[model samples]
Target: MTPFEPDRSEDLLNRLKQDDKQAYEKIYFTFSKELLYAAYKKTGDRVIAEELVQNIFISLWEKRQDLQINNLQAYLFGALKLSVINHIRSLVMENKYMEYQMLTYSENHQDTANLVDLHDLSSIIEEGINSLPEKTQEVFRLSRYQHQSTKDIATGLNITEKAVEYHITRSIKRIKEYIKNFYIFL
Candidate 1:
């Protein structure tokens, strides 16, 4: 509404700090929609925007007694902005981790690629591949050889992505063992 007029706001704030449910509901109904719109404009995700606003209200209620504010609108907007930045930072870190995983497990095979002939190695790798059960072998090939994402492999194979991950892990462990033993004897 019109910023809750100062006298009413002061009364509501006092009730809120005292854990009055109706006062909390009053504040939520007044500010939540506007906060959601502001958050959506900043984050460009409707679901995340809604979540941020809900989190703000929850935090407001939990820390109501500790909060002191001359302008409630300013406080809510400022808190939403900080929460949005934190969410963006978390997403960026998750993306970087996925990229790191892809690069670490990439097909470059750096160490042995330089020391061994790929033909000999491929044959030894083939031995490891042949040893796997059929379904595990399929998932591993899709993930490693074809460079398909776990999502893609899961969709293509009609299996859960977690299942694809398990198969990839099982196959990689078996193949690495084969390669390591081959290196030791050489």
Candidate 2:
């Protein structure tokens, strides 16, 4: 590629600062390929390299009025290098976030599986409660399901406190046996 003459480069820079579209186009055509090659060499990806170079030109145009470029070529190359570094940093952060999300999802999946097992155990216990004698079912339901105290259960059922305790113990023993047999069959 032919290098820009010193006088011509000075003229281009002055015109570019004044928002001259033709000057901007000349600069783009002169430097775009070199910048793309440099970006690709650093990043090793053609698409990313192209995007970085494009963004550099876009930023140059947007900030043309504010730019005080002593050497346009050096400035463009410097921007390309910084952009590539930032892109790599973003990729690393994205990978770490994805890994964390995957770990959390796996843990949550295990919790969901445990909840399903607990639900099945609850259903089995309900079946055992249903199989109890009618009076025992009333006492067990009042004490466990309704969260009533043993004394309250005896008063409500008009039974002695000892009878309430006996029914609770009997219900627990039968449910434990039912659960053990159910798991053995599974």
Compared to the true structure, candidate 2 yields what TM-score? 0.54
Worst 10 residues of 2 by lDDT: 97-106
Query: Candidate 2 overall Cα lDDT vs. reference?
Result: 0.82
- Return the TM-score for each candidate structure: 0.55, 0.54
The 0-to-1 C-alpha lDDT of every candidate, in the order given, reads: 0.80, 0.82
Instruction: Report residue 49 deviation for candidate 2 (angstroms).
Output: 1.0
Tens-digit lDDT track of model 2 for 60-127: 88899999887777787798889999879867865885576567667778578558857888988988
Candidate 2 lDDT at 84 equals 95
Indicate the residue-level lDDT of 87 in model 2.
76
- lDDT, residue 123, model 1: 85
Candidate 1 C-alpha lDDT tens digits along 58-172: 6797799899977776788899989999889868865885576467754667555444656777988989998999999999888878999989999999998757866776686
Give the runs in model 1 whose Cα sits over 4 Å from its true position.
1-4, 107-186
